[model samples]
Every structure is written in C-alpha cells, then in structure tokens.
Target chain A: MSSVSDRMLTSDPVVEVENLVAHYGSHKVLDGVNLTVNAGEIHIIMGGSGSGKSTLLRHLLGLRRVTSGRIRLLGHELDGVHRSELQELRKQIGVSFQGGALLSSMTVGENVTLPLREHTRLDESTMAIMARMKLEVVNLGGFEHFMPAQLSGGMIKRAALARAIVMDPKLLFFDEPSAGLDPVVSAELDELILRLREAMHMSIVVVTHELESAFRIADRMTVLDCGKILISDTADKVRNSANSRVQDLLNRRPRVEELDADAYLARLTGE
Target chain B: MPIWMHGSWMMAETRLGRVEQLGKRTLGLIAEVGYLAALLTESLYWIFAGVFQRQPVRVSSVFAEMMRTGVSAIPIVFLLSFSIGVMLAIQGIHTLRTFGAESQVVIGIALSISREFGPLITGIVVAGRTGSALAARIGTMVVSEEIDALRVMGIQPVRYLVSPVLLAMLVMLPALTIMADFAGLLGGAVYSAMDLGISYAAYADRVISVLKTGDIWQGLIKSAVFATVITLIGVANGFSVTGGAEGVGRATTRSVVLAISGIVIADMVFTWFLNR
Candidate 1:
C-alpha cells in the first residue's frame, strides 16, 4: 500500500482543466472553466444548484466530453485520449456518485470487491480481505454482507466510499458526500474523507453544495457560479473574497437578477 | 412585404421546417439502427474475447436471466399458443367443411403453428414480458448513474450487463418457442378430438405427415432472430433513457413496441427466405 502512497506523492498535478467548455445540446453548462488539483490535497468545488460544478466534475472524470478544452489527469491529456487509454487512466481514479450507485443486485461486499475482481487477478480470499479492510476504513467492517437496499442513507454513503477507495486509487472524487444525511452522519463522513486522504495519500476532488462540509474538508476550495469560476483559493481566502457572487454563495443569499420584460415576453411567445 | 404575403411566407416556412424535422427524425432512426448493430457486434466481440482470455461469461447472471426470460415465460407462451392453435383449428374446420375437406384442418393447424405462429407468438409475449423488464431495469440503472458508476469502476457496461442477457435470450427464446410449438399442437389435438369428430391418432398422424423438420427449424431460426431483436432493442432503449422515472417508463414502452415490430418484420423476411 506504501507503493500507492509513493505514486501519489508525485509533484505533478493530479487533475488539470483549462479553458473547458461543455454543452447540453445548444446551451453551455460549463464555459471556459479552469481548475487544477495538486497531489495529496482535498480540492472542494462548491457552487449553488445549476452552477456547473457537477458538470466540471463529470468532465474531469472523462464521463462527459468537453466541447473545447484540455483536461489532463496524471499527466495525460484527455482531449484526444483513445478509449483504451482513457479506461487505463480511469483505473487510477475513483468516483463516488451522489446516489451511491451501488448495483442493487450485488451485496455491499461484492460491490466493494468488484474493481479488484475485474482489474486484478487476486485470489478471492485476498480480494475479500482487501474489501473488508476498506469497509473497516469506512467504519462498515461488519456490514459488508448487507444489501444496499437494507442500509441506511448514511451507511449507503459509507459503503459507496468504501467501494470507491478499495482499489487505492491515486485520485478520488466525491459527488455530494454529505447529501441526504443527518448533520452528525455528514460530519462523520467528512472525518472519514479527511482520514482517507491522509492515510491513502491521494488527491481528492469533491463536488458539493454543503458549505460547512466544504469549509471543513477543503485544503483549497473553488467557488463556481453559472458556468464560471468565481474564485479558487484557500477556504479562508474564498470566504473572505470580495467577489459579490462568492459572498452571496457563502452567506446563502438569493441571487436577484433583474428580468427584462421584452425578453420575457419574447420567450413566452416562442420568439 | 404586404401583411397577407408575410403571413403566407411564414406558413410556407413552417411547412419547410416540419419537413426538415421529419427528415432529421428519419435520419435519427437510421443512426439508432446503426448504433444498435455496432453494440451487438461489440457484445459478440467481448463474449468471444472473454472466452479466449479465460474470463468466462458470468454463468450465474446468464442462468438468472435464462430463468427470468425463458423458464418463467412458459405459462403465458403456452396459453397464448394453445389459444391460437384452437382458433386456427376451429376456423380451418369451418372453411374445409364447406368443401368436404375438414380432415385437412390438422395439416393447416400444424403447418401454421410450427412454421409461423409459435415463434411469432413467443416473440410477442416475451417482448411484452422480458423485453420491457430489461429496458426498465437498465433504464433505472442509467437514471441512478449506476452505468456511469460501472464505467468509473473500469467495468464495461456492455460486457457486464448486456452480454449475459443477450446470451441468455439466444439460448432461451428458441427453447420457449419449442415449448410453444408443442403446446400449440396439443391444443389443436384437444380441439379436434372434442369437436371436429377427428381422432387423436389421426390428428397426430396428419400433423407428423404434413409438417417437416425444416418447418420447425425455420421457426427456431426465426425465434433466434426475434430473441436478438428483442434483447437488443430492450437494452438499447434502456441505455438511451434520460431524465428519471418518466424516462424509464418511456424506454420500457419503446422497447416493447420496437421489439414487437422488429420481430414481425424479421419474421416476414425469414419466412420468405426460408420458404424460397
């Protein structure tokens, strides 16, 4: 496992995005977004709903193609990477989706061990031991055999986290880790994430709207608004930034943009 | 331009737009067909690759799907095929009796069931039953991001999800069709003995004499094609689902409709080719 740490300690950027643009059909969801995540650091991407943070995360993961931009993960540019190369690159990264996304047909233990089974020729016993170790790391040691449907919301998140990190990936991504959890459970998850980063020595990129969790776990935070990055700095610097959009987001203020009556009428009339 | 002329110009432009939309939809349908064919080719490649690489097909998943798509469908297929057989016999009797050839009813029923009705009915039933289920299952997985999750885990969804089900359908649909054929013959026998004043032995002999092994083989071949069409359409529709629950519902409906239509069209082509 120290080999994983050794690999993770490289000075190269774990994730790099430059001038990234993305679209859902004709409408742009990410406009000229740029980000960089360094080794062994927890980078929090924070934004309100529809702020393109998730879209950015998807692009970083190579799950979505960029309309125009560069995404370099672990020194490999993703723009024109072949399918096999992209898959090989993805093997070094792990993503925990917002909904857990564990296969309902498989038990939690099976879900956690799926990557090992697919990518490694390890014996079943070894895979089981590794899966149990990860579950223990996430405080789900004894509940590995439980079905995902039987788990509580907090437990499901923990199980998903265990599955994500079972391969000891160099770069880990979390999508709203604290969503749908109580305050106490959310805090516990935050602690688990921090501990995982320290123990595994991996770079982490978290997409979240939870301000408290963001501030608590982020080594550096990037705030995005309406498809553009407002600020990318240390937590305190981001909180203290002069940008009105950053301040509004941090203070939970409703954004008020004056509507144009003529535009509104034209939209209603399908013009 | 004058106001009246401008209105007419707008109307003409709208008609042109509608035509363009229709053309785009036609092209989209063709693209979808091409995509599905590519997916099928890729799935076959993976299956063979797995075999050569010693990564055997997931036996447990294939067996589970076999039970779901094939074994569990027996009762409904039986009922449907039996009813069709009985109806064909009754109608054949009525038509033949007018010409003093009511005994030919057995030949008509046997030929129709073995060469056409059995596979077609089995396909339609399985399309409604297993095809919709496949679409909904995969659609829900898509909606919940599980497919993306699998991709993130370095597991190709086509290999893990579609291949086993495809293999299962290939194995099972023909098996179900055979069962349907037998049930249909039995139903025809029952109808003939009870009402048509025909003996069971006479009816069986007539069926055996009039029906060739080639007829059964053709029907089985058609079932295999129907199986591929049903599962491919189902999985393709599932993968294409967007939004959420509503998307899953729409995918399920589309899978069933598309599978049934594809099966019938395929049946027509197979019948023509096999008979010729």
Candidate 2:
C-alpha cells in the first residue's frame, strides 16, 4: 500500500478522462475536459460555481452520459460499456455526495450496510456486524441506530465516509466534503480523508472549491475553469504552477462595488 | 389617409387570430393530456396484471407499505376529518334552522362526509403530507445521485422505491378513508351533543339512518384514485428535479401542487361518474 504519489513519478494512470464533453440542453457544461488520477493518490478538482467540476465527477462515476469523448476507469472504456456493465464497474468505485446524502429514511447502520446488502449475499447478522465495524472505523460506533437527519454535519459526513468505504472500493469520489463546514471541521475532514486513503490504499478524487483543503489533502490537483482544465500538477508544483486563471482563483481580495450608477439609472429609465 | 377604418379592421382581425390560436393551442394540449392519461392507464393495468404473473406478489413489501401509509397517516387524517365534521355540523345547523329543519343537520354532515368530504379532505392532506414528503425525498435523492447510487447497486428505483410507496398508498388509502368517515361522524356527534343539546345516541341514529353502502364505497373509490394520483405526481415531479438545492426545493413544491391538482381532477371525474 505504498503512496501512489511516490510511484506516480513513473506509472500508468488509474483513471483517464480525455476530451470529455457533456451538455445540459444547449449549454456545454463540460467541454474537452481531460483529467487523470494515479493509483493510490489523492486528486483534487477545484472550481468556482458552474465551472462543471460536479458534472465532471458525475461523468467519472458514470452517473451522467458523456455527450462526446472518452472516460476510462482502470483501463476499461466507460463509453463503450453497457448500462448493466457500468453498474458492475461502479461497484469497484465509491462516492460520497455533496451533502453526505445518507438515506435519511434509513438508520446510519442501514445506510452503511446497503452496498453490502445489495452487492453481496451476506446474512442479516453478518451484515449488521460489518456495518458496525465500518461505523467504528469512522468513529461513529454508537450512532448506528440514529437516523441521518439526527446526525450533526460532521457526524453525517463521517457516517457517509463509513458507507462509502463499506465495500473497500478501489476508487472513491467525494463531492464537496468541506463546502458548508467550518475551517477546523474542514481540516479534520481532510485529515480523515488522508487517513482513509492510507488505510484502504484507494485512489481518491475529491471535487471541491476549498483551496486550503485541496492543498492539504491532494497529492495531485486539477484546476477546472470555464469547463476546461487550467492546471494539473503535483501539489508542490501546483503551488507554483503560475497559471493566471488558477492564481486568480487562489488569490483573494475584497470585492468593491464599482457600479456605474448613471448607466444603471439610464437602463432603468429605458435610455 | 383615413387611418381609423384600416386600424379598426386590423385590430378586429388580430383579435380573431389570437382567439383562434388560443383555441388551437388549448385543443392540442387537451389531446396531449388525453393521450398521456391513456398511456398511464394502460401501463398501470399491465403493472397490476404483472402482480399476478409467474411470481406471486410479495405480500411483505406491500404490507409494510400499507402500514406506512395507513398507520402513519391516521393522526393527521383524524384531526382533519374532526375539524371538517364540526364545521359541517355547525354550518348545517345554522342553515337548516331557517326552515325549521335543524334536526336534518345530522343527516347532512353524515352524508357529506360519507360521500365526499371524507375522501377529498383525506386526499388533500395525504398530498400535502405524504405526497410532498415522498417527492422531496426522491427529488433530493435524484439531485444527490443517491437514486443513481441505488441503480448502480442493481436495485430498480421503481421496484425498490416507488412500488413500495405506491403499494402502501393503494392499500392504506381506503383504510384511511374509512377512519376519516368514522372520525367525521364522531366529530359531528360530539358537536351535536355539546352545541345542540342532542343526545349521542340520537345523533348516531340520525347518521346511521341516512348513510348508505354506495356513499361509503364512493368515498373509498375517491381515496384510492387520490392515492394513485398523489403517488404518480410526486414521483414524476421528483424524477424531474435537476441541478442542486434550489431544484430539489422547487420539485417538492411542484409535486404538492401536481398532487393536489390531480386529486381534484380525479375526484371530479369520479363524482361525475358516480352521479351518472
């Protein structure tokens, strides 16, 4: 279970997405997007709102159809796969949704045990035990009986993490784990993410806009802007990637309201 | 140049053309709605027939669904029916008193609940509570990719998700209607006993004398139709939700509106047929 970052210096890509294009009606949400994540490495995808980062993640998970181009996971072409076969392919991957997306109707234990119940023929007691073990791993040991609605923001995320790794998938996709959390909580989640990758030896692709979280957890990173990849590099190299768009995003300043009041008034008055 | 004559003629022609366009559009929309209704009816028939195919219907899932629909909905249904019953009794008493027919208040309230109000109110309540909740849950699931997760897990969203809910509502709605009718009667009885100084036994007797099997069955039928409409509308709205948070919220609101509208239309059709 060596870190892929060490081996990524010379190795095959674990996930390959090339010239990917996706659309919502006439809007080209993902345009010629290309990305690669090496085995056992944490890859971060960062973008502002409507930058198609989430859309790209869905494509990687095969949740959305690629309007054009190619997406290959572990050397298998996703575009050529049948729907049933895609489901089979997806079992090898895990996803944690933007808000943790735990089934609110089900107890935390039930949520953790779902993939096992669906993909395996395990008996009830064994499934329960396995779910408990996963919960324990996420430090949510005693919260199995609680519903997802009852869990705190942090607890829900941990529970979702437990569920995502219940099957010990080869690849894990997390969507915005730190979006709504405080900085300290976000950092804690980042540490947990790194720990999970280390323990499971799984490749992770975290889709987020949080620069600090990406910088902390990512071994390699891609910056998506206007439906295109602005940069993809090692975390250390990415810091000095010197791409203007990426730098503009990472660099922050106070936004001054420099409105042209006369022009605005003229427009309002139908001038 | 006499501008007035030409302009008047042009305005008349424009008004006539607009009317014709609107009429055509309305007709086209009605035709589409009719086609969709036919398609849905056929599909539901096939689904119902499939239940009796090689593999017998699993009683457990249907039973669990029934429990969810019937048991969970009892409290709200009772409260609604109780309030309606009280209101109807009071209204009937006031109206009937003018003609020295205040005694007929029992029959009026009882017959209304048994035939119409019981089912209609229950249906609307179900739409507001169960239908909207189901839509929100399913819509959020769609937006979150949880529904897709289920599909990737090899579980059919219809079978695992919608069918349980549909079955639950179908089995439970009639039962809820029955409870609603009974509650309505109890509410009327309580109102009559307290407000009108009528004995409980007398009120019960008046209600019983006027209530018929047809009335009860009509309410039951309305409830069943309402349940079906509510479930379908909820699921359709849910599956349509796109984007993120705002889309989900909008879907939930739309589902309730659709469910309520569907219930009203279905009730009207049923009522018309029952009268015919």
Candidate 3:
C-alpha cells in the first residue's frame, strides 16, 4: 500500500464512518469499510455496479441500518437518533439522489420550499421568494410551476439540486450525478458542482461510476471493489495509482472473460 | 419421463406454489391490517381534533375535493341508478300486475331507493372511482418517495394526504347517495308516467306514503359507513404498495374490491345491530 500523502488529506473530517458493515438478507454489501468526508471538500466514492458505494451513502444518510460500526455526522452519532432528530440532521445535509427524486405531485416551487416550510417559520411569500432564488441558483429560474413529469431529465436534476440546496446545507451528497446524462450535460453538471462548492464552501460526498465525472469534480476519491476500498487518493493520484482494479476501472478496458464455454456446453448437452 | 407426466407434475408444483403464495399474501395482509388499525387509532385522534377543534377546518379545500368526487361521479352514478330503477319498476309492474296490485310498484321503488339501493349503488360506484383514485395516488407517492418527502418535510402524510381524502369521501358520499336516490325515484316516476300510463301525482303520492324519516336516515348512515370503508381501504392499500406502476395498479384494484366488500359487510352489520 502506498503511504498517505501529507498535503492531499484534510485535517477536519465532517463525516466519519468506522468499521462500517451493512447487509441485505445474507449478502454483505459493505464489509468493514472506513471513510471520512471533511468540510470544504468533495469526496467521491467510485465503484462498479454492486460495489456498495450507494449502500455506504445510504448509511451516511441514515436511510439504511448499519449492521455494525458507527456513523458520525458533525460529531453526533447517527445511530439511535430519534426520527425528528434525524429529520433535523437531514435538514442540514443536502442529498441529491441518483435519479432526480422530485415529488411528482408537487411543482418545482413546492418541492424546493418543502424543506423551508418544514424547518422555518418564514411566511409563505418569503418562502416562495427563497425557493425562486434557489431555483435561479441551479439555473432553473422561472420554471417553478412546472411539474416534475413535464421537465426534461436535465431540468429535473437541476430542480432536485435546487431543492437539495434550498436550506444551504453544510454537507451535500450526490448519488451518481452523471449516471444518465449525456457528456455535455454531465460536464455542465460538473461545473455546477464546482460552482456550488466554491459558493457555499460545503462538503460534498458523491457516489458515482462515471470515471470522467469522478476525476472532474472529486477533490479526493475512494474506489470500492468487492466491498473494500481499492484505493483512496486525490484525483490526480487516483488516476495514476497502479492498483489493477482501479486501473481497470479508470482505464475502461474490458477484463478477460473467464468462462470455459465449450466445457460448460458439453456438460449441458452431454455429448 | 413422458411429456404428459412431466406436465402434470409441473402443474401440480405450480398450483402448490400458487397456494403457498396466496397463503403468504393473506397472512401479510392480515398483519398489515392490524398494524394499520393501530396507526389509524392514533390518526383518528389527530383527525378529530383537526376537524372539530378550535382551529378551523379547511372547508374550502374539503368542499373543492367533494366537488371533484361528487360532480365527476354524477353521470356514472345517475346512469347506473336510473337503469336499475327503471328495470326494477318495470319488473315490479309486470310481477304485481299478476296480483292486480300494480300501484304497489311505486311503493317498491321508493322502499328500495330509500332503504338500500340508493346508498348501495352509489357506494359501489364511488368505490370504483374515488377509492381507486386515492389508492393509485398514494401508491404512486409511495413509489416515487413523495410520501417520504412529506415525512422528511415534517408533514404527517396521514394528516396532510389521507385526512383530506377521507373527509371528502365522508361528506360527499352522503350527498351523492341523496342525488342517486332522487335520480332513481325520478327514473321510476318517468317509467310510471310514460310507460305505465300512470299519472305522476299517483306515483308521487304512493312514494310519499312509503317514505319515512327512518328510511332516509338509514340510507345516509349506510353511505357514511361505506364512505369510511372506501377511504380507509384506499389509504391502507396505498400504504402497503411496494413497487412502481405495477404496484399502483394492483393497489387500485385491491382497494376497489376491499372497499366494496367492506361496504357490503358494514351494511349487513349495521342492519343487524339496528334491527336488534
């Protein structure tokens, strides 16, 4: 293992997970994972499908039960927090889901102001103004009255981002920010991510499979493979890291297929 | 193995699997109903306070929803109730003519509409329309994580979403039943005047003699209970949904069936208790 770099790491970790383990039925999706996301940094967890990156994000959000280990958000243990407390915690952290998770019943304006209405005593007019401000921040100004179904995929994602940041959360999490976007749109979203980081000075934890996106926006990245971290380093270092798994994932070269088709077919046909 | 023998074995296995699935689903549904009963007890406390407390109820919102439920439902309800009423009148006339008691057909139509047919038919129609719509809406919200969004927003999904529908259904079902009752009576009156060659006044007189306060109140009570059953079943099915569009469709169908059955059963229980 390579030694940890001195300058690449942050001293203040805002979110910390130790010996994290999670399971679904008998399948252990996350096995003894440890990671930290600090304030004013973008920590990207990159992995192939079924590599437990999303599972780990869900644990951080308290959306899933941690089979074992502790998740601390801003020095508070997330486990056993009351539902109301969890909601309060969630209000301070913005999470944009892989799919734009806008409520279909609500218009863009209503969706953005939901958090404000819930957490603040602001009157409806002020809340609406705040909602419009956030919408404009995400470059979706004046599209407030459109339904989620009516918006295009890119616009819906922006609306969701606007909703996520409506409260100016200290920590922002994105699950696959570029999973379904075209390259141009994805790059534009990357710019938005960078702009948000600069403007708010908030920590962002992005779980994504798109290597281009990971390299573009990530301050530091962790690559998960087979329920373990293969490598963790800055964007430049992770790209150059010779870990075969990371290299294969980053380079996008197909691995050799290992199945012996002839033998398998002979056994089935019995000829 | 012979193909027919293998096919028979597969059929048996499939049937046994289906039986097992049905058994599992039935048990799951019972457990869900029990859990929902507990939730509903708490929700009922909140709903009553919200509706009748010092704070005013959103009468405008409730009335708006009632208009949606009642107005859209009228054409279908009227069509069903009128046809049934006409058929019942024509059949009663044919049968009562045998005994030379043709005038008694007016009394039959009035008695059925006032005591049973009006509420029952209206309940079934609303169950199909409103109950299914409510279930589909809730199930869609569940699948889309909209209900979770509401919860995260510190709004109780039960109070914000379910309560509005329940109140609307409760208030409107009775109103719809009254309209259906009038339409059914009108259908009978039309047949009596046009086809039976009986004067409208004679038919109206017979209906007035048979109609009583108790008859109308019983129908109204049945409508209220039916509305409660329909709304509750819709909400329950919506909350139980698991997957996406397929789950919404399944919940809607299940809601309609459960609401209709619950209405029929409640009607039976009410009549039994009231008679005793």
lDDT for each residue of candidate 1 in A25-119, tens digit (9 for 90 to 100):
99999989898887888889999999999889888877898899899998999888887787788788988999999999899999999999888
User: How large an RMSD does model 2 have?
Assistant: 6.5
Model 2 residue A170 CA deviation (Å) reads 1.7
List the pairs of residues colliding in candidate 1.
none
Off by over 4 Å in 1: A1-10, A258-271, B52-56, B196-199
Ranking by TM-score: 1, 3, 2
- Candidate numbers sorted by DockQ from highest down: 1, 3, 2
* Whole-structure CA lDDT of model 1: 0.90
Model 1 TM-score (B-chain only): 0.96
Report, in order, each candidate's fnat: 0.74, 0.31, 0.23
- The 10-residue segment of model 2 chain A with minimum total lDDT is A250-259
- Residue A85 of model 3, lDDT score: 70
Candidate 1 TM-score, true structure as reference: 0.94
Cα lDDT tens digits for candidate 2, B1-276: 379998999999999999999999999769746754654454354347634432223466677767766788899999999999999989999999899988889988988999899999889988998788877888988886678767655455665677667777887888889999999988888888887899988888787788888899999988888988888778767877898889888988988997898888888888899989
- Cα error, residue A3 of model 2, in Å, equals 6.6
**DockQ of the candidate models in sequence:** 0.67, 0.22, 0.28
Sliding window of 10 residues with minimal summed lDDT for model 1 chain A: A1-10
Q: What is the lDDT of residue B276 in candidate 2?
A: 90
Superior by lDDT: candidate 1 or candidate 3: 1
Best by lDDT: 1
Would you list the C-alpha lDDT of every candidate in the order shown? 0.90, 0.83, 0.83
